[model samples]
Target chain A: MMNCQGCRDDLVAYLDEELEQSMQAQVEDHLERCVSCRQEHDSLRQSYEFTETYLSSLEPSPYLWTRISAGLRGEPMPVRAPWSWLAARISNSAVAVRLAAVAILVLGVGSSWLFYHERKLTGQARQEMVQFVADWEGLDVSRVNPFLARHEHPVDELEANPFIDLHHHDIKNPFRHEER
Target chain B: MKRPKTEARAEDERIGELQEWLQRSKQQDLEAFHQLYQRYSKRILNYIYRMTGSVADAEDLTQETFVSAFQNLKKLKDDGKFESWLFTIARNNVYQQFRKKQIPVGSLDAGGEEERSEYERIAAPVRDPQEEALYSELQHVVNEVIEELPEKYREVFVLSAIQHYDYKRISEIVGRSLASVKTDIHRARLRVRDRVKRYLGQSS
Candidate 1:
C-alpha cells in the first residue's frame, strides 16, 4: 500500500538492503506494480554499478614507504629542498621554544625601559612646575601692594590732586572746543 | 555479492595476522609496523587521493597518517579495528590539511590541470584504444561530479562506493552517526547518477 512518493523515498535504503523484511516486501510489491518506481530503482542500481566499474584504486609512489620510514625514525626526508629543510629545522620544537623565549625577553626589557623613561619624564615635569610655583610664592608682596592700591582710588580724589592738571590739560573737556 | 567461504576465511586469517602485527608494533618492533604499512598504505593513499583529488597531496597526507599512526600505536585500544582507525587518521589528516590551507570544500580548482594530467599519466595503461578513450572520458566526468559534491557527502560516498566500506564502518571512520552516513551516501549516489545519466544522454 506504499504510495509512489513513499516508495521513492525508501528506494535508496531498499537498494542498500537496510530496510526491514516487511518494508522490503512492501517496496517489492510496489515495484512489481509500479513501472515508474521500478525504473527509478534500476537507474539507481545502474549508477552504483557504473561507479564501481569506473572508479578504481590508484597506485602510490614507490618511494612513499621510504619517506614514511624516515619520518618515523626522526630522520630528515632526503628529497626536501634546502629552504624546506631549513624551514623544518626552524620549526623544530626546541628551536621554536628558544625563539619564543628570546622574543619574550626582548619585549620585557623594552617595556621596562619605556616604563622607566616615561616615569622619569613625568617626575622632571612635576618638579619644574613645583619650582615655578615656589618662586612665585617667595616674591615680595609689599612692593606690589602700593602699586595695586594707587589704581584703587576714586576718580574724584584723583581730580583734586595738584599734580593732576584736569582743567589745563582739558582732561574732562578734551572733546569741547574753546575760543581762548 | 556474497563472498565464497574460502575467501571469507582468508580475510579472517589476514585480520588475525594484522592483529599480531599490531601487538608487536606496540612493542616498538619496526619490522612489524612496516608490515602493517605495506598492507594498508595503498588503500589509505587512494582514500586520501580521492578525498583531495591530488596525488601529490595524497602522498604527503598518507605519509603523515602512517607516521602519526606509528607514534600513537600504543594508544590504540582495539587492534581489530585498525582499518577503521587508520582510515580515521587519514580522514583527520586530509581535514587538517584543508583547514591549514583554507581550501574550500568541493573546489573545482582543487584538481588542477597539472594534477589531472599526472593522474591520467599514472592511471593510463595499454588497452584497446576505443574503450580507453571512452573510459577516460567517463572517468573525467565522474571525477568532476565527485569533486563537485560537498565535502561531507563526498567523503561518505567515496568510502561507501569506492572503498567498499559498509555503513557501520564508514560511520566509525568518519565519526558520524550511521543514519547520517546512510543519508549522505544515498544523496551522493543520486547526484552522481543524475550527472552521469545526463552526460550519457548527451553523448549518445
Candidate 2:
C-alpha cells in the first residue's frame, strides 16, 4: 500500500531495521515492486557501509598516547600558559582550606568595621548640616548686625568646615576593595 | 543498530570497568588513566579524524582532550558520565579549532529544520544511483563528504555511524534530544548519499 515517496522517506530507517514490524512489512512490499525506491535504498546502504568501513580503518598514532601521557605529567601544559596550573595546584592543596577560612574572617571583620565607621560619619555629617543650615539662615554676611557676632555663622567657627560632609561618606569609597 | 543481548552485557561490563578505572585515576594513578587512554584514544582519534579530516590535527586534538580530561577530572561530578563528559571536551576542542579558522561552528542543540534543510541542499546535489556506486569504494571521497557535512549533522553522523555510539549516548554528548540525534543521523546518511552521487557526476 505504500508509495515510492513513503518508502524513500523510510529508506534510511528501513536499512537500519528501525521501522516497526507493520511499517517494515509495508516498506518491503513497496521495495519488492518499486524498482526505483529499491535502488534508493541500495544507494543509502552503500554509503552507510562505505563510511563505516573506511572510518573504522583509522588508527591513532602511538605517539599520541605518549603526548597525552606526557601532558598528564605536566610537560609544559598546552592551551594556555604554564602558569594555568597554578590555579589547579592551589585549589588542590590543603592550604586552600585554611586560606578560604582566613578570607572569610577578613571579609566579615572588614565589612563590620566599614559599617561602624559609616555610621559615625553619618552622625557627624548630620550634626554639621544642621548647624550649617541654622547659622546660614540666622546670619546674613552682608548685614552688620549684633546677631551675626553671636551666631558667628557656625561655618566660620568650624575649623576648615569647607564643604560640610553633605554626602555623609562613612568611608570615602568604601567599595574600594584594595584600600580595605 | 540494535546490539545483541551478549554485546549489551559486554558493554555494561566495560562501563563498569571504566568507572573503576576512573575512580583509581582520581587518586593520581597514572596506570589507571593509561588503561582508559588505551581503551578510548583510538576511537576518539577516529571520531576526530572524520570530523576534521586531518590525521595530524586529530592526533593532536585527541591528546589535548585526554590531557584536559585528566586536569579537570575533579570537576566531573559523576563517574558514570565520564565518556559523555570526555566527548563534550573533545567536541569543544574541535569547535575551538573551527573558531581559530573563523568559521561559525554550529551547535547540535541549535539545529533547526530549516537550517538543516538549507545545509543539506548545499552539501548534497542530486544525481543518479549508478553514479554513487562508482565512488562508494573511494575512501578519499567518502572522507571528503563526511567533512563537508555541517558540524551539527557531522557530530551525530560521526558518532552514530563511524563510532557506533547509540542514540542515547550521542544525545548526551551532543546535548540534543534522542529524537533529534536520530533524525540528524538519518538525514546525514541521505545527504551523504547525494553528495557522493554528485561527486561521481562531477568526476565522470
Candidate 3:
C-alpha cells in the first residue's frame, strides 16, 4: 500500500480525472489499502468540489453588467474604453494624415482669400494715395487765404527807406537849382 | 412525411432568422445589437466574473467587452464562430489588461519557442479544496495564489483552473504546444497546492 503522501500527491489529479490509467489504478490500490490516504483523497476531492461550486455560484456585479449592456447600445463606456486595443489598431499617423489634408485645404483657401483681399487693399491704398496727391496739386494757391491775405513784409520798409526818399527829394532841388 | 418536412422547415427558418439578426447587427443596427446583448449578457457576465476575481470589474469589463464586440462584430470573418470568437475577443481584452499591468512573473524560457512552451506545460497547478462551503474561499485563495505564482504558471493556472479551458484551447491561446500546456498546468497545480496549504496553515 502506498503512503498518505503518495495519495495526497495524486489526489488533485484524481479529482480532476486527469490521472493516467496506470496511475489511476495505483491510486485505487492505495486507497483500498490505506485508510489515511483514503481520508486524504476524500478531503482533497471535497476541496476541489467546493471550489467548483463556489466559482460557479459567483454572480457578476449587477450595475456593471447594466452599464455593459447599455454600452452595447452604442453608448460609450468611459472607464472601459479598451484604449490599448484602440492604440494597437489605430495609429496617430492616420489621424495626422487626415488632419494634414484638412490643414492644406484650409491653408489653400485662406491664402487665396488673403491674396484677393491684399490685391484689393493695395489697389485701394494706391488709389487713395494718388487721389491725395492730385487733390494737393489741384489746390489753387492764388485763392489760398495764407498767400492772398498777405501779411506785412518787413522787407518792404527797406525798399521804401526814408533816407533814400530824402536823398531823392534833396537831389531834385540841386539838379533844378540853376533853372530856379 | 409532412412532420419531417415541417420540422426541417422550422429549423431552417430559425437558422435564417438568426442569420438575419447577425447580418443586421453587422450593419450597425442598434436594435439588433441590443437584441444580441439581451440574449447573451447574463452568460457573459457570469463568465467574466469567474475569470476576474472582482464582481465589480467583471461587470464593467463585461459591458466593455460587449460594446467592443458589437462595434467589431462586422470584422468577424465567420459569423458561425460567433460564440468562440466573442469569447476570444473577451479573452484578448482581459489579456490586454494583464499585459497593461506590466507585472512580470518568472520566465518559462526553454531554448527555442519549444523550450518556452515546455515551461507552460507544468505552469498551472490545481490546488485541492477540502469542502464545498470552502469552495468560494478556495477560489479567492486560488486567485491570490495565482497572482503570487510566476507569470508562466499564472497563465496556465488561470486558463485551466479559473477559465476551465481545455488544454487544446489553452494551447492555442498561449501559442504553446499541448504537451507544454499540460506540463505547465501540472506544475502550476503543484505550486498552487503548496501555496494554498501554506497560506491556510498560516491563517489558521
Candidate 4:
C-alpha cells in the first residue's frame, strides 16, 4: 500500500518504464484509487506528448552542407570575418564598440613594441656574432680544418683520374659494337 | 511510433549499409564519408540548434563537430559506436563554445527575440489560421522553457526528448552515470511541464 507521495515520486519512472514491475504495479494501484495522482500522471503524459509533437526537429539550411564540407577541407566559410560578426552582434552597444576599439589599439601598440624589441635584440645578436667571427679569424686554420688538407688531396686525385669513371657500368654485350 | 516489421527490416538493412560506409570512410573514401555526412548532418544540426537556440551558433558548432569528428575518426576504435562518438564531439564543442563566450546558464541573451522569430518562421504550418496562431504561441512558450533550462539539465533533456536517445546512450553522450542522467532528465521534464502548463492549459 504505497502512499500518494510515494506514488507520485514513481510516476515519472513508471511512465518511462524505468520502474520495476512490482513498483509499477504499486503505482497502478495507487492511480486506480487516487484521482489526484491519476490526473498528475495524465498531466505529465500530456506534457511529454505536447513537447514531442510541437518541438519537432528543424531542417537545417541548405548551405549547411557546403559550410561543413568547406570546414572539413580546412577552408574558411564563405561568410564575413568572425570579428565582423561579433561587431554586428554588439552593434547596438556604443560602449562595446568603443571598448573593442580600445582593446584593438592596445593590442596593436603592444605588438609593435614587442616587434621593435625583438628587432633590436636580433640586431645586437648579429653584431655580436660578427665581432666574434672577426676575433676568431686570426686563429690558425689548420687546427680547425682537418678536412681542409684531405679536401685538396681529393681534388688532386680527381684531376689525376679524370678519365677514370667512378660509376660502374655493366656491358651486357662487350663484343657487340655499333657500326659507326 | 511503432515501426512495422518490414520497416524494421529496412532499417536493419540501412544500418548494415551505414556500417559499410563507416568502414570505407575509415579507409579515407571521400564519397563514403560524404554519404555519412548527408545522413547525419540534419540530425546533428537540429540537435545543436535545439541546444543553443541560436541558429548561427548551432550551425557553427555543428560544422565544428563534424570537422572534429572527421579529423579524429582514426582514433575511434569501434565503428559501431560512431553515432555516440559523434554526439560526444558535438556535446564537447557546444560546451567549449559556451565557455569561450562565457554565456551564463539560463540566460535569455543566449537565445532572445532573434531565435524566437527564427523558430516561429520555421515551425510547421497548421491548416487553420486560429490553430496556427495558437500553435505558434505554444511553440514560443516551449522554446522559452527549453532555453531557460539550466545547462546541465538542458543537455540531458534535449538528448533524451528531442534527440530520442535512450537513457544509456544519453549517459554515454553526456559522460554521466545512468542514475545521474535519469535524475536530471526527470527533474528537467518536471520543470518543462510546470513552466509550459499555462500555454498548455489554454491550448487544451
Candidate 5:
C-alpha cells in the first residue's frame, strides 16, 4: 500500500493515465485509505482537465493564420545583406582590381626613387667629409716646436678611419619594406 | 456542391501531402517547398501569434521563419520532427523580436509580466465564470503563463501541455534527452502550481 504523500505525488501522472497498472493500483489503495489526500487529488484532477479544455477552445485571434501564412511565404519581409558582400564587390570588380595594380605600380616607382635619392645623399656626405679633412689639414694651426715642425696626420688615414664610415653610413631608409 | 466537397477534401489531402513534402524539401526539393508552404502557412502564423501577441509581427516572423527554414532545411538533422524544427525556427524568430523589444509594443505592464511569468500564476487567478465569459479569459491566462516561463522550461511545457506532445516526441523535437524533457515539464508544472496557489489565495 502506498502512503498518502506518495499517492498525492503521483496524482498528476495518474490523472493523465501515465502510471503503470501496478502503481495505479497502489495509488487507488492509498486514496481509499485517505480521504483528505483523495479530495486534494480530485481538485488537482479537475483543474488539469479544466485547463486543457479551456486552452483548446481559445483559438488564435482572427486573421492570425492569414497573416502568418503570408509571412512564411516571404512576401513582405525586410532585412539587409551583410557587409562582406560590399567588400567582395569592391575587391572583385575589374576596375577595382586594376586600381589596386596601378596603386602597386605607383608604390614601386616611389620606393625606387627614394633609394636613388638616398644613395646620392650618401655620396655627397662622403665628398663633404673629404673636403672637411682637407680644410683641417690646410689650416694646420698647430705648429711651432721652435723649428715649426708640423704634426702631419695623413689625410688618407682620416679618410680610411672607421669613424668616417660610421658618419657616412646612410640613415635608415623610411620607405624600405624589407628589413635591412 | 460536388466542387465544394472536392475542394475541402483536396485541401485536407494537400495538407497531408505538404507534411510529406516537408521531408523531401530538406533535401532541396523545390516542389516540396511550394507544397509545404501552401499547407502550413496558417498554422505557422497561429504559432507565431501565440508567441508574440501581435498579428503583424507574427506575419513578418512567419514569412522569415519559412524562408529561413526553406534555405537551411539541409541543416535540420532530424527530418521526422520537421514540424518541431520549423516551430523552433519560428520560436527563435519570436524570441528575436522580444530581444529587439518589438513585441507587446507600447506597454510595460508589471501585472502583464507577472501573469506572463508562469501559466499557473495567470490561470490560478481566473474565476469560474460562465463558460462563455471565462473561456476566453482562461485562454488568455494560459497564453500569459506560458509566456512567463523561462525559455527552456516554457518550450518543453508548451510542447507537452499545450501542443499535447508525448515526452519522447518533445525530446525528439527539441533534440534533448527524454529525461531532460520530462524534468523540464515537471519543473514547469511545479512553478505553475505555486502561481496557481498564490492566485487562488489572492482571489478568494
Candidate 6:
C-alpha cells in the first residue's frame, strides 16, 4: 500500500534485506504491482553486479612481476637476462648466498674433474708400466748385466747392493748401505 | 533456524590452510610465502586499484604493502585473521601515500575517485568481447557513481556491495558501529543507484 515515493525511500534498505519481514512483503507486493519501482530495483541490482565484476576483473600489466622482482633484488634491472631471471629476483644478501652456491658448484665440478683426470692418468700409467714389464720380463736382467758391467763403478755397484755397508760399524743392521 | 554449515566450514578450512602457509612463511619458506602471495595478490591488487583510482599507484602500493608484510610478517599474532590484517596494511599503505602527497583525506565533499582509464586497460579474455565491453561500460558508470559517494559511505559500500563482506566484518574494517556501517552502506547504494539510473534506464 506504500506510494512510489515511500517505496523509493525504502528501496535501498529493501535491497539490502534490512527491512522487517512484513515490510519486505509489502515492498515485494508493491514491486509486483509497480513496474517503475520494479525496474528501479532491477537496475540497482545490475549496477552492483557490474561494479563488482568490472573492478575485480582488472589485472596488472604483464611486466609487473618483473618490476616487483627487480625491486626485491635491490638492483636496477636495465636489461633482463632470461637465464638469470631467478638470479635477478634474489635480494642483495641472497646475492652473496647465490655467489657461495656458485663457488660450491664450481668446486664440486672442478674437484670431480681433477679426480677423474688423475684416475685416468693413473690408469694409463699403470697400463704403460704393465706393457713395459711384460716386454722386459722376458730377458731383461741378464742382457742388462753385460751392459751394466762395462759401465759399472765399484762405488756405484756397492751402493746398488743395499746389503753392503762400507762404514758405520756401530750400525746394527747388516742390510744398511753407504749413504751415497 | 540453523543455517547450512558447509560454506562456513569450508571457509574455516580455507583459513586453516592459509594459517599453515603463513606459519611456513614466517619460518623463511619463500615458496610458502609466494603461495600466500599468489592466493591474495590479485584481490589485493584490485582493492588497491579501487582505493587509489590509479593503476600505477595501486601497483606501487601493492608492491610496497607486500614488501612491508614480508619484512614484518613475524609481527602478525593471529593467523585466522590474516586477510583483515593484510587489508589493514594495504589501507595504511594507501593512507601513507595520501599523507605524503598531502592529500586532504577528510574532505568527504571532494567527490569521486577516477574509474575509467584504469578499467579501460583491462582486456577481458572471455569469448564474447561485446558482452565484456558492455559490462565494462556499465561498470564505468557504476564505479563513477560509487566514487562520487562520500568517503565514509564509499568505504562501507565498497566493502559490502562490491567486496561482499559481511556487515560485522565491514563494521570492523571501517572502525564504525554496526548500525553506522549499515546506514552508510545503504546511503552509498542509494547514491550510486541514483547516479547510474540513467544508464540503467537506457540499457534496460
Q: What TM-score does each prediction get for chain A alone?
A: 0.40, 0.36, 0.33, 0.40, 0.35, 0.32
Q: What docking class should model 1 receive?
A: incorrect
Task: State the weakest 10-residue window (summed lDDT) of model 2 chain B.
Answer: B107-116
TM-score of each: 0.69, 0.58, 0.45, 0.68, 0.50, 0.57
Best by lDDT: 1
The CA lDDT at B20 in model 6 is 87
Q: Rank the candidates by DockQ, best first.
A: 4, 1, 2, 6, 3, 5
Q: Write the per-residue lDDT of candidate 4 for residues A27-122, one digit (tens) a residue.
A: 999999999999999999989988876775566666767776776666876552345355336533565678789999999999999878655654
| Model 2 per-residue lDDT tens digits across residues B1-204 | 599999999999998889889988888788999999888887787677656654445667888898888888889998988888989999889879878866566322111222223222343435577754543346557756776788889888888777777778999998899778778988898899899788768878
Give lDDT tens digits, candidate 5, residues A38-118: 987776665566557655312333343344344455565333223323333343346457878988999999999977765
Q: Write model 1 residue lDDT over A1-180, tens digit each, in one string.
A: 899988988887788777889999999999999999999999999988887777655776667788888877789965532343333434445665787898899999999998786566545554544343333335333322221121234557867898986555735331122335
Clashes of each: 0, 0, 21, 0, 7, 0
DockQ of 1: 0.18
DockQ of each: 0.18, 0.15, 0.08, 0.19, 0.06, 0.11
Query: Which is superior by DockQ, 1 or 5?
Result: 1
- Measured with C-alpha atoms, the lDDT of residue A98 in candidate 2 is 76
**Cα lDDT listed for each candidate:** 0.77, 0.69, 0.59, 0.73, 0.61, 0.66
Segments in model 6 whose C-alpha atoms lie over 4 Å from true places: A1-43, A50-56, A60-180, B1-12, B106-122, B126-135, B201-204
lDDT of 2 at B172: 97
lDDT value, residue B113 of candidate 1? 40
What level of docking quality does candidate 4 show?
incorrect
Q: Which 10-residue window in model 6 chain B sums to the lowest lDDT?
A: B106-115
Q: After superposition, how far is residue B114 of candidate 1 from its true place, in Å?
A: 3.0
lDDT of 5 by residue, B1-204 (tens): 156888999988866776578677867676667667655665676566555544445556776787788888877776556777887788778777787985452222333222232223433445566864665565566656556777678777666666766777677667789768766777777666555556556767
Off by over 4 Å in 3: A1-14, A17-44, A53-58, A61-66, A69-73, A76-180, B1-57, B77-81, B98-143, B199-204
